[model samples]
Target: MVSINDNFHCNGAYVAGDRTIKCWRYPRSHGSETFVQGVQNSCNPVFMAVAERLGADRFYDYMVKFGFTEKTGVDLNGEAVGIIHKKENIGPVELATMSFGQSFQITPLQLLRAASAVVNGGYLITPHFAVKTVDENGNTAKVFEYEKGEQVISEETSAIMRDILESVVSEGTGNKTYIPGYKIGGKTATSEKLPRRSGKYIASFMSFAPADEPQVMCLVLIDEPKGVYYGGTVAGPVMKELLSNILPYMGIERDAEGTEEIFTLMPDVNGMNLKDAEKILKQNGLDVQIRGQGETVYGQFPPADEKINAGTKAIIYIK
Candidate 1:
């Protein structure tokens, strides 16, 4: 929760109506805490200050800049755009409340998009579970294309944020979500819903891999879970499970000289960029067949992060 508050809480005043924008300041380490450790301990006031320093308008701009206000128009059913109350819609106390994920609501997809942007080099992307769209003739087309959804910050800023999130799992409140071998980066958020009055928490965990240059990302949310209700303890494990089941399924290599000696079948590379995806295949002594002119990699025939048999043709499409 401290990590959430540290990243989300803020206070500020703007020209009231401008959409164009901008945005920490962290917890002191007086206790047995280190850099991110202070924040990971869920030190309320510290994270609140971080959010306060970021201010509300800039944070709200980030929300829009990251595609939270729009529906993303994905093919998935029952999609909902995150609803954030703007300046006029909220004030000092309200904004501070929002700093820790209060006074706001976002769907699973919306949250995933925002978190993905942070881990994906500050580029917001349309989240899609399906691989591609197929025509009646069986000719396939890419479903979503990556086109710089929005540049929310400099690459440096994203790198810093990624490190802080990684610290959350390595040594902070979210330590429970840490996975061995894979350099997992993530943040935890636990917020109390309004009007319920009975005190229920919404737990969420967002994560990615190769922290430096994330290849894939994920978000998990657990509603009204019993006993311990925190982003780390509750949502972190779910996030871990998703990766445990999905990463091996994706066929990502574990050896240092990956694909050097043997070639494996491709799993799924639905959200990867073409150049990056192609590199993996080329190094594996495999071939690629691209079907479209899309610049963003939308889907892979054999898929990604998975292992495969020798001499497999890995088909990938970009937007």
Candidate 2:
């Protein structure tokens, strides 16, 4: 088990060989913080230091074990095996950059699979679409199964990671995705596109609901968002919107008490005046997103009578 009290210092940047790796919160030093705090803060120096302790060989081994260097063998064609630095070529700088997810490439599915293993008791599961085929009268015709690979981490370690990740949604950068009465765990990412300093980024958020025992997982990536491109800002809300609808449909009841969110049925605003539609939606505790410049609302999304969490954005189209 990892020690929560293990301390790491972040003095804006970490020096590795001839390179200096700066924290995302550059110029603002976090003098010292425990491992949990470091994770909550998304402090780069803490991860860099941890990678230093693991050394290149051990770190690379973990990467390989996590299925980073190979294709996941998913039930899809033309799946790409992502790139990673060769063990021998990984110097101090390379290790540091890779420690916090850089200097390498992996598909979104690959990352999701690895994340599943981390939270689902460490068993690497093969992802597939079909579960079973049915015959004419809805009778089962054939069953399909996928492999669950060897355990890559101890159950105890997996539990710890789950708790840490849960806190990430509750109190860290991922807090934007948290929904009341639902236990959610997630991580936000803002990946710089190739040809560094190009002012382009992919904002993404990976999340699982009912964090204590995940039933559904989602990975949302917003490619080159127009503005406010931080993952938490751009993708977290999308994940929240998705899970709000999905969890209940899956029959997963909210387990917590005293903090249930207020949900409302979307109202029909079609053919209504824009001001009247806005007033009606606001009365229902919903927000509005107009799609056109016209004053009359010709259409509405979540169209009418659909139940959604309060504060959800209702889109209205005009002609």
Candidate 3:
């Protein structure tokens, strides 16, 4: 197991071969801190040190094992396999840059899939849109299954990663994505586009919910966003907004103590038959307050996509 407390000094710059890698906190040293602290700080030198320890061979092997060297075999066509330095061509500078996720290119999906393995009990899963097809009446028509590839890391290691990543959201650079009463694990990145010093970047944040037992993962990438382009600052809020609405819609209950608060999205019941609307509201664990005696719903309070606690009363206007 990799030591979370491995000591590293980040004086904001690391030199490898002819290249100089600088941390985001360049010109201001973080002095010395544990590996865990380095992750929290998003310190570049810590990762460069770790890469040095792993060496080129093992690091390149991990890149291949994580499906970085090939397409993820997704159902979609025209999927591209990202670029990675050839094993023999990876020198000290290459390894250092790659350690902090530069030097090579990877699709957002590829990064998500690899990140998933680190917290998903170490299983590499194929991402797909549908698990099964349903008939018009909602009867299961056919089932589709994707491969759960080999375990890349031990469950114990996955657990540790989960804890560390959770800290990233709760107390680190990804703090902007944190929501009260929910466990979140995430990483933030600001990737510089090609042409080196080009003033362009893709700010991104990758997150998963219920850090101890993840049920959903999200990757938000903002391409060449204007002003304040750091991932934690720009993309973190977007990720937070997304998960805030999505988690409750998916019926994932909040983990607050002394309370079991479950939430669901408000369905658009306007234009639905009164009885049908009532049924749908009831199914979503909402109590209905019908206004005016009529056969069809004309309006609804707490409108569609709003997150409401389960058993909450929904006011539906009829006509």
Candidate 4:
């Protein structure tokens, strides 16, 4: 969470009215963080300070340069162009909010395309549906092709960004989304609904595998989920689940070597009878412990669809 004191005087005030921007942080993290760590912790103050330094003109130029203001022109139907506030009206407050993904809105596809460019050596390749085609006799036809677009950022900038993004998965809020044997990099984001007073959120995570040379960029967004809504908690696992299957299927080898056990998604045992839930848990190689003397389960720790190490004890609460 940011207080008025967190403002850096490099350019602007950290004002969002009387409301404080509550941010979640790790317990072991010191009160202050570096720029890279800011990416890891998802600190609003750090980005705000950056936006303050960049000011409105440079920030708007970067955004427009990244294709935030125009349609991606992908060969897809119904593509929605993203929205950006006018440069003249973007004052300190507006700039601060926009820096951390508020005030202006971008479509997921747009963000994904831009992200792909960020990691794919700065070339924004148009996304297509097919990678390759096979004929009846197993002869491979040419896969879909897209025009190689212009470079939006420098290779050095992309490399630096990739390293920072990799740090996110290795040591930051995205740690849960890490795969054991692959180099993964990405960012996690949770945006509050417009007007900021509404308690609803849009949780999202964007990832690319084998960070040294990204092959694919995966984007996951969850809207208004129940219980916890942090991007790391909600959207991170969804990305992990997808890549866990996709990486292996695409013949991407695992690079992790150790005794680390494979993780599986926690099953939905809530509202099930105790007998049935226990049976299902056991079938999935999980040890179950009932927390109350009741026949019906009310909840389960680790929650449904979340990845947990195999054989971890699942605590099922009953009432």
Whichever of 2 and 3 has more TM-score, that candidate is 2
Off by over 4 Å in 4: 1-30, 132-134, 256-319
User: Relative to the true structure, how large is the alpha-carbon lDDT of every model?
Assistant: 0.67, 0.87, 0.90, 0.80
Relative to the unseen true structure, what is the C-alpha lDDT of residue 252 in candidate 1, on a scale of 0 to 100? 59
What TM-score do all the candidates reach, one by one? 0.63, 0.81, 0.80, 0.73
Candidate 1: C-alpha lDDT: 0.67
Which model scores highest in TM-score?
A: 2
For candidate 1, report its TM-score: 0.63
Model 2 misses residue 2 by how many Å? 4.4
lDDT of 2 by residue, 1-319 (tens): 2387898889999999799989888888877988887887778899899999999999999898889998888889999989999999999999999988888999998999899989998988878889999999999999997777978988888888888889988998898898877889988888888988788889999998778898889999999988788888899999999998999899987654612355567899899999999999989888788898888999998879897778898999987
Preferred candidate (lDDT higher): 1 or 4 = 4
lDDT by residue for model 3 over 1-319, one digit each (tens)? Answer: 2598878899889987798889888989788999888888888988898998899999999998888998877779898879999999999999999999998999888999899999999987777888899999999999997677889988998999999999999999999998878899999998888988888999999999889999999999999989888999999999999998998798986675412345567899989999999999999899789899889899998899897878888999998
Give the worst 10-residue stretch by lDDT in candidate 3.
Answer: 255-264
State the displacement of the C-alpha of residue 138, model 4, in Å, after optimal TM-score superposition. Answer: 3.6
Alpha-carbon runs more than 4 Å astray in model 1: 1-35, 129-144, 254-319
Which residue runs does candidate 3 get wrong by more than 4 Å? 257-319
Root-mean-square deviation of every model: 15.5, 6.7, 7.8, 10.3
Tens digits of per-residue lDDT for model 4 on 1-319? Answer: 2332343321122444344433344323234666777778777767877776787899998888778898888778988987899889887778878878887889988899889888887887666777789999988877766778889887987898888899899899898899877889999998887767688899999999888888878888999877888899899989989988988798887754611356667899999999999998988788788898989999998799887766889999998
